[model samples]
Target chain A: MDATTVTTWMREIETSVTQERDRLVQLDAAIGDGDHGTNMTRGFAAVVQALSQDQEAPPGRLLILAGRTLVSSVGGASGPLWGSALRSGGRVLGDQATFDGPQLVEVLAAALASVKDLGAASVGDKTMVDALEPAVAALGRTVGEGASLADALEAAAAAAEAGMRSTIPLQARKGRASYLGERSIGHQDPGATSTALMIRALQRAAAASS
Target chain B: MAIQTKPRKFLNDPADVVKESLAGLAAAHGDLLRYDRAAQIIVCKDAPRAGKVALVSGGGSGHEPLHGGFVGRGMLDAACPGEVFTSPVPDQMLAATKAVDGGAGVVHIVKNYTGDVLNFKMAAEDAADDGIRVASVVIDDDVAVQDSLYTAGRRGVGATVLAEKIAGAAAEKGASLDKVADTVKRVNERARSFGVALSSCVPPASGKPIFELPEGEIELGIGIHGEPGRRRAALGSASEVVDVMVEAVISDLKARAGSQVLAFVNGMGGTPQLELYLLYGEVDRKLRAAGVVPVRNLVGSYITSLEMAGASLTVLQLDDELTELWDAPVHTPALRWGV
Candidate 1:
């Protein structure tokens, strides 16, 4: 995958978040402030605007720009969570014009760690980590098995979707929802849902390139 | 599926609520405040008074009279208002910090929410890069939840108002940024708050309650954002509710017999001032029975949610310095004394 593929991923995320805007807001409304949808939509729109202004940037630079935009535009916990992830991943990618299979997997691992560090949340906390950690691990496993980049992303997206669904039965251990305690058990995590959306966007972008 | 009842709010477009609120604030209190639409910051007209430490505090917009209303002489130098229930971005804070920084430097009075803390940390770093000295004190006095979505520890609630007043007074006295910060930290340590929500508040943008409370039920330990409380219990009489809120706060603060404290009974926007005064009476009675003296008291809607029908009680054990600062002249829209 190259810079165009990366840009495609960002574009796809913008579209997907826009389409799922109400759903994400409803999910957050169940346990949060109900602005996740609005915040994510605004953040992605800003990302697209920033990216468009500098279309010829390297893949790493594009992701970094998107991350910074999210951090500044989205004014909630999700801003830092998603922003630090992409920023750390972009830093590791370090001006790479192209993201090969191993480099993509490396970015996923680094991004996951960065988000976890910023949020202090881990898997089973019923946050974005519920989706993100699994997707990263699935992608790592698939790539290690010699799968193509598209196949690995597809597998990761599937894992993320499953992880998002799995949040339905777990009580939240972090975020505003945790204040609900046992009452938070039945709702899907909005952060995890958005994470799944991003993973699916990545998979679609990779397949489009193939 | 049943039809959902959308909350009724008086406003134009939700998008323009924050902008218009600032406009109204600026219009009403132009003598005290100057609003910068581009920067979304409310600045004291007399900010950056030479050689005085400047104080800045802000959060999401719904908690009105909080950050913005507290901006003036002997209080906050500036307030950065974010979208409702969302943290202000770094740019807003950076601008406020820079615009208000006197030669004595600027101090950020940040609430303990994750978003606010992260954004303020970023702004402080950004200001440092610009050669503006910045220090910060994080207020985490809500003892209801140990850690919640936006906080790693206690949530900053009522004490934020008190901290701003006391610290703002310290700054006005020409204290160094470090000294002002130390005073703010001490204020935070000496304060504790607990809140109960009789109903949920709907942000203008969401157009729905953040959470649902069954009829005749109350959410105890509720945060200012209308976030879920520590527990949901059957609604009780005003005295009962005040008992629960005051007792929990006292226990959390370990208030023993003969402890002199400043008690604040804060209205959560929708609640009437009459009810807040009633609640304050109950709180005062309980503290006296527990051998705690209510030395100074503030009863009103200073820090509030947007039309959330609830109240929070804050207990601040005060020393001589804190009491003196609290009594210091403060001229602001929401709070005033010794003017």
Candidate 2:
């Protein structure tokens, strides 16, 4: 992806987060603090503003700036988790002006690992990892099979949706939802849902580029 | 709006709750505190008092009389309240730290929630980049859960109030930032807290209860944000609840029969002072019976959840130094003594 394309994807994610803010907040209200939606909205809004100011920067630097903005602007667990993920992914992307399917897969994989490390969560922890890990795996598989970037992203988004759904029955093992213990079983994990939304936004941006 | 059956709270807009509340606070206590509208920080009017280390503390909005209300002569030099249950962003902390640095440095008394810890870490770094010295102490004295939603260890609850009071007094005494931080750390290490929630509380933005507890059900070991507790049990008598909470704290602290402590009984927002006093009586009796002498005590609502109906017990094993600091004069919006 080029710088412009990365910027487009961020804007898409911002729009998606804005549109789905209340839903995400409602989900959090059930099992965690009800500020996830507001926090995500604030973080992404800051990212968009930062991106707009430094539009000439390369994709890697732009993503890094976005991550830093998120970390500074958003509070609560999601801030550090999402911020570190984007920062690590951006660092791996380095100063590359453009990237391809394989490059994007690597970026996602690195981001997923960063989140898992920061949150200390695993696949069954009912966190954003539930959505992000599956999506990364699907993207890696499709990209390794030499699929088009668009196709890989589409597959990744679908896998993320499924992963998010899977969190509904999970006993949370991390994040604020974990405090609910057995009570967390029925409520959907808000972090997973928001991660799915982010992946879907990436797919939409890729399709538009294609 | 479907006939507007939502729970009514004394709020203008959900988003403006913190700002409005801080505005009212500053207005009411203009002589003692100054609220920075843009930065969302409440600072003591006499901030940057020459050659004195400053104490700063804050976290989410619902816990009133905490960081903000305690901003005065002997408590926090500055307070940074965020949106409910959310940590204040770095900008607020950096600005407040810079504004309140009295040439000695600043000490940040942070709660142990993930957000507060991360945000404070960033803020400390940012302030340090500007050559402002910053020291920090993280309070995690609630012995309820080992690891919960966003905490690595015990949640910081009642002990936070003790930390602010004792450490604030240390700063007031012209102690260095490191000394203040060290004193606060000692207070945290020697303190333990336990809480029980009678009912769930709704944030203004959410407009719905956070959790459901059947009538006569109580959640033991509740965090300050109304986060789910360790376990749910049928509502017992006031004495029974107090006994359980006091016992948990005393056990966690490993207090001997002759241990001298400062016992604090704190009310969650919706709980009345009368009920808190009733509970305090039980706590006093229980501590005395256990051979722990209540050398000093505090009772009332200082740190609180948003209208959460419950109480928390905090026991600080005291030493001469801590006792002297605790006895020092304090003048704040919520807490006052020895005028």
Candidate 3:
């Protein structure tokens, strides 16, 4: 996608976080510090504001800028996890004016790898990786099968929804929620849920662009 | 479900809490510290002491007098305070690391939390990229939590106080970065802590107590960040609570008969000094009976959860060297002796 497309994706994330803030906060309150919603909302608002300052930035630079803003403003685990994820994705997409399904898959894979590295989390850890890993895999599968970017994103978003639901009964193994151990079970992981929202936002952005 | 109540705090606004508190600290200890308004770091007045190993430590902000309050002559060279109960960013840590590098290298004393460890790890990498040698030790001394095989290893709590003291002293003594990191790790290995909460704490951003505690109930093995502890039970007498805490810490520490210990009874911010002192007496009695003798002790609110009415017992298995480090001259706003 182009710079404008990337900016739209960020604005879409801001809207999603704003709309789902309380749900994410309530979920975190069940197992964490009760601020994932607020943190995401704050981080993305700054990302949108920052992107406005450099509207003509390349796709990679736009994402790196957004990631840096999240790292500075989020002030929680999400700061580094999502920050590094976007930064990694941007670095992989370097200098591309526009990319296709293969590049999107590569970007998602790089994001997942960065998040897993930064958070030391993998599938079933009940973190953002829970949703992100599945989304990346789904996007890769659809794209490898010659699907369009919009269709691949839609598949990834659906898989992320399923991954988000998967956290409902798993005990948290990372983040503030992990401190609760068994108490964290039965609660939807706030990070995973927000990540599902984020992936869906990407799907919508891709659909609109296509 | 029950209705939650807003916590009562004296603040001009929720967003300004950390900044305002840091400003007040700078105002109160101008000679000892310089607060960086833009970077939001607390640096000792005489930092970058040539030929000395610089010690840097930080985490979330709600734990007052922790990384910041202890920045002084024999303690930390700098501390990066994050939003309340949130880990500080790598940028802040980078600034602190750069500000305190003394050519001998720098040591980062990180608490073992996912956020704290991750951010510190990033900052350490960034600093290393900048060609500054950095050594880091993640203290995980809380017996209430498990190890790294499953969960993030034990949450680093009360022992951070002793670690900062020992590491700071070692750095001030011109020890190499390795020596300071080694000494701090030793203290972490020898220390164990257990905390209990009689009430919940509030994050100003939310304005409500993080969790609801019914009347006459207490949470045992609570996290310093207001995470409900291992178990909740009916509130018991001070002596009864201290007995449980002592037993858990001693058992986890493996402190046997004739073992000398430094006992630190830390209040969870809202608790008064009288209560902490009384609990220390109980801790002392129980430790003596358990054959773990307390040769030195500190009873006060040092590492705290904002306005949470509780206390934690930290017992450091002491040797002559550690005790010497503990008694080393220190001058800080929250701690001062032998100055």
Candidate 4:
């Protein structure tokens, strides 16, 4: 992906987070501190603003800047978790002006590892990892098969959506929702849902770029 | 049971609530502390003292007079307040850490919330990167839920006040950073808290109660932010609520007979002084009867959830060192006794 395409994806995520703010809020209210929506909205808005200021930056630098901005502006579990993910992914790209599908999967792998490391969550823990790991695995598999980037992202987004929906039935075993134990079982994880939104934004940006 | 149903708070703008409050705080207590508007930190006027380990603690903003009001002599060196229920950013924390670094080192007292833990983790790393010796003591001493190796574990509650006080005293007395951290860890290990909410709390941004609690029902085992709670149950008398809270706390703490304990009864914002005192009375009686001797007791709205009518009970089994630390003079805006 190119710098402009990455920037478009960030804006797309910001728009998606804004539109789904209340839903995320409601989901968090049931099992958490009820600020996930506001936090994501604020974080993505800052990401967009940061990307705009450094329009000449390469895709790698833009990703790093966006991650740093989120870490500084968001001020929540999501802030450091998402910030580190983006920064780690950006580091894999390493100021490269453009990268192909295989490198994109590497970026996804880097993000997944960052989040898992910081959050200490696994696939069944009902966190952002649920949506993220599956999407990354799907993207890795599809891209490895020599598929186009758009098709790979489409599969990734679909996998993320499925993962997002899957969270509805699982009990939260990490984050604030974990404190609720069984009560956290029925509610959709706000973090997972937001992850799905972000993955879809990547797909949309790639599709539009093509 | 007619009551005030109006949703109201004295705020100029929802966005500037924390900033405006800090402004007023600085104006009123300029002698003790200063509000760093640019960095969003509430710091002691006498910070960065050459020979003392500085203490820094903070979390969401609504828990007023908690991280902020406690910044003064013999207590916290700095407090970082975030927006409403959100945690303070790492940049803010890093600024506070750097501003208060006294060459002796710094200790961050973090409550065990995901956001607070995550943000402080970043700040601690950055501080170390900048060559500032820093350590963090994470407090998670709530008995309202079961804590396991997995999950976020228990929510930190009323005992945080005790940890801050005792740890701050240790830091002020020329103790090394490790010793002070150990002191705070002791408090965390011995302290257990349980809270109950009579009504839900409204965030300034949302302007509505975050959760629904029908009248005559109590959201027991609630956290400072009023997260749905451990569970909801029928409302009972103040004395009954105190019994439940005391029972849960002492049981979780496993306070054995003939052991001396420090009792603290805290208000959850909207609760009146009259009610808090009454609950303390019940707590005193209950503890004494159960052989958990109450030695030092504090009663007030120290840590709070804004406008949420409720109360929390915290018990700390005290030894001589902790007792001495607790009795140490602390001077601050909201809580100060001995000079």
Top model number, lDDT: 4
DockQ of 1: 0.53
| Pairs with steric clashes in candidate 3 | none
Q: Which residue runs of candidate 4 sit more than 4 Å off their true CA positions?
A: B1-7
Q: Candidate 4: what is its chain A TM-score?
A: 0.98
Candidates ranked by TM-score: 4, 3, 1, 2
Chain A TM per prediction: 0.98, 0.98, 0.98, 0.98
Tens-place lDDT digits, model 3, residues B1-339: 346555577889788899999999999999999999899999999888888999889888889988799998999899999988888999999999999897999999999888888888889999999999999999989988877556877899999999999888888787888899999999999999999999988878777777899999999998788778867898889888887899899888887789999999999999999999999989999999999889999999999998999999999999998999899999999889997
Model 3 chain B: which ten-residue window has the lowest total lDDT? B1-10
lDDT scores in order: 0.89, 0.88, 0.89, 0.90
Cα lDDT for residue B324, candidate 3: 91
Candidates 3 and 4: which is better by TM-score? 4
Q: Is candidate 1 or candidate 4 better by TM-score?
A: 4
By DockQ thresholds, what CAPRI class is model 3?
medium
Q: Could you report the DockQ of all the candidates, in the order they appear?
A: 0.53, 0.46, 0.66, 0.74
lDDT of candidate 3 over A1-210, digit per residue (tens)? 788878989999999999998778778777887777878998899999999999677898898898999988886789988999999999988887887888888988999999987787889889889999999999999999998787889899999999999999998888777777787889999999999999999988877777
Q: Which prediction has more favorable lDDT, 1 or 4?
A: 4
TM-score of chain B of each: 0.96, 0.97, 0.97, 0.97
* Residue-level lDDT for A36 in candidate 3: 79
Best by TM-score: 4
- TM-score between model 1 and native: 0.96
Report the number of the highest-DockQ candidate.
4
All predictions: root-mean-square deviation over Cα? 1.9, 2.4, 1.8, 2.6
Question: lDDT tens string, model 4, B1-339?
Answer: 235344587877777988999999999999999999999999899888987999999899998889899999989999999988889999999999998998999999999998899999999999999999998999998887789865688888887899999999998889999999899899999999999999878888766678888988998888898687778899999889988998899888987898999999999998999999999999999999888999999999999998889999999999999999999999999879899
